[model samples]
Structure formats: structure tokens, C-alpha cells
Target: VESLSFFPAIWKGITETADALRLTVTGLSTLFKGVDLKETVSGPARIADMLGTTAVQSFSESFRTGIINMFSFLAYISISLFIMNLLPVPILDGGLILFALIELVTRKKIPPKVLYYIQFIGLAFIIALFCIGFSGDVAYFFNNFRGIQK
Candidate 1:
């Protein structure tokens, strides 16, 4: 009976995690397949702001509610990072996997110089993404600041 009691909780957690993964994948696909970049992409600052807001709202309700909300959000974030790490960007795990696949298919080791250039391009892409996200964060805060002044 004691063992049976925890089964439902475990099952629910597994199902919820799977659901979150599915949703994240779908969202990423939509974003990549021509969704409006500005509305979808947000920087670390924006994400932190959102997390702070969530924490406040959750704690305002009750201790148990707050704890649950924080855990759930953290789980979602972990899953997101896992999925993002699998994206085929040269600096990420997916890029490594992609390189391995290429080597397997061609049966030749990629040259060092080529690898350097590929990694450099990936770095540039990452920097560009950060710039875009940071700009968006700045605009968001600026607008909010103006609204408060009025």
C-alpha cells in the first residue's frame, strides 16, 4: 500500500514532463518555421524578469503553491535547455552529433582549419542572437519605464 501510494505522483510527473517537452518542441518548430522573431525570442534579462514575476505571484498565493510553481518552472527550464543543447549549432551538442554523422558518412576526419571556420561562424551566430535579444530587452524596459513615469 505504501508503494502504491507514490505511483500516481510518479506517473503524473512523468506525464507532465513529457507534455512539457512536446510543447517546447512544438514552440521551437513554430518559431523556426517563420514565426515573428521579436515576439518569440527573448534574452536572459527578459527571462529573469519573467521568473521574478512568477516567483512573486506564486508566493503571494501560498507557500505550497509557490514551491510547486517554482519547481514546475525549473523543470520546464531544464527540459528546454536539454532540447536546445540538441539543436545543430556548431558550438552545441547537436553540432557535435552533426559532425560525427558527417564523419561517419564520409569516412574522413574533418580538417582542423574547416572545423575552426565552422566554429567561428557558429560563434558569430550566437553573438548575433544575443545582440538581438539584448536589444529587445532594452526596448522592453525602456517602454515600461516610460509608462511608469506617465
Candidate 2:
């Protein structure tokens, strides 16, 4: 009975975390499908700016609201990152899982040279994504700044 007391809260957290993961997956799929890449994709700078804006607005409303909102936002970001890190890209955890699975099935290890090249490709892909996100952030800020000037 004592241990069961925390079940409801634990369940709620699990559900909410799953929801965040789903949202992150959906967002990534949408972006990859090129539905609104330029408008939706954001880099670290853009995310920070948005976070700051949200914090200001929420705190202006109420301290409690601000705290809740900030924590929620952080959780969402954390979940998104977790999902992304699990993607089957060579440099990430998912890539490691993929390699392990392949080795398990084939009963052999992947060559070091092959792994190196694959990781290089993954690095390139990550760099490309970073560039895209950074460019989007620059464009977003520039447009907003221009709007302010006008």
C-alpha cells in the first residue's frame, strides 16, 4: 500500500514523457517530409530566444505559472533530445544499437575502417542539419528585426 501510493504520479509521468516523445517524432517526420522546414526547424539560438520570450510572458502572468511553464519546456526539450540521440545515425546511441544488432545477426564485427567512414557520413549529416537550423534561426531573427524597424 505504501509503495502503491506513488503509482498514479509515476503513471502520469510516463504518459507525459511518452506524449513528448511522440510529439518530437511527429515534428521530426514533418520536418523531414519538408512540410514547413524553414518555418518550423529551429537551432539552439532560436530555441533559447523563444525560451526567454516564453519565460518573460509567463513570469509576467504569475510566478507559479512561469515555473510550471519553464519546467514543462525543459522537459519537452530533454525528451526531444533523447529521441534524437536515439536515431539510427552512426555517431549516436541509436547507431551503436544498430551496429550491435547487425553484429548479432551476422555473427561478425564491423570493420574499423567501415565504421570510420560511416561515422564520417553521420558527422556530415549532423553538420548539414546544424547549418540548416542555424540558417533558419538567422533568417527568423533577421525577419523579426526587420519587422521591428518598419
Candidate 3:
């Protein structure tokens, strides 16, 4: 992104991003339906395990396919990251953007006290989410482990 200073570079990026977003949205549309959401939103451990399994399977198919598969997985992950960062949480880039938009429209700087509270809320929400994801991951791992032991 830093290297893309001019029009062509920026335009290409925008277009490619649109395509990636479309692909990602299409793939994950069901996740947003509020059905079995805990199972849907995987944590870091599950994500890593899935990726490792994919890489191994792809490599089993052949070296070229493995490379292509890894790149495709990365593209999807990149799209997910982009979308996640844009979620309107106060600690994320989206929150900063929201403040900027507000300042633009209101022609007044947001109160420092309000910003502090908002950030605190965001921090709390983030921590809660991390705890949930971590707990889910641990449960998932133990479940798999138990099945193996049986």
C-alpha cells in the first residue's frame, strides 16, 4: 500500500480489492446468518490447524497445486483481515474513520472524554471477544483429543 502512491497503482489495488471482497463475502455469507455462530467464527488455533491441513492436502496433490492453493488461501485470509479491520469498533481503524467522518460533518473535534470512554469500551469488547475465541479453541482441541483417545 505504501508503494502505491499514484493513480494507476491505487486504481488497480481498489479493483483487485473489490474482487477479493466479493469472493470472500460469497464464501462467508452463511456465517452472517446468526446460525451456529460460535462454530462459524473460528479462533487462531483452528485457523492455523485448518490452514496446515489444507497445505498438506494441496502438497499431496502436487507441488504446483500446493503453491496455488496456499496463495488462494492467503488471498481469502487477506480479504478477511481487511473486512475485520473495517468493523466499527473504537480501537480499530474503522473507529478512527468514524471519528474522522464525524469531525468532517460536524466541524468540531470530538471531546477527549468521550474518546477515552469509547476507547475503553472498545478495549473491553476486544478482550471479551478474545476470551470467547480462545475458550472455543481450547474446547475444540480437547474434543478432538478425546475422540483420538477413544
- After superposition, which runs of candidate 2 have C-alpha atoms over 4 Å from their true positions? 1-7
The lDDT, on a scale of 0 to 1, for candidate 1 is 0.87
Of candidate 3, the 10-residue stretch with the lowest lDDT total is 1-10
Misplaced by over 4 Å in model 1 are 1-4
Cα RMSD to the true fold for all candidates? 2.9, 3.6, 5.8
Instruction: Report backbone clashes per prediction.
Output: 0, 0, 0
Query: In order, what lDDT does every prediction score?
Result: 0.87, 0.89, 0.83
TM-score of each model, in listed order: 0.90, 0.91, 0.80
Model 3: residue 46 alpha-carbon error in angstroms: 0.8
Q: Pick the winner on lDDT between candidates 1 and 2.
A: 2
lDDT tens digits by residue: candidate 1, 1-20 = 12336889899889999999
lDDT of 3 by residue, 47-150 (tens): 89988998999999999888877876877787888887887899999998999999999999999999999999999987877777788888889999999999
lDDT of 2 at 56: 100
Off by over 4 Å in 3: 1-20, 26-32
Top candidate, metric TM-score:
2
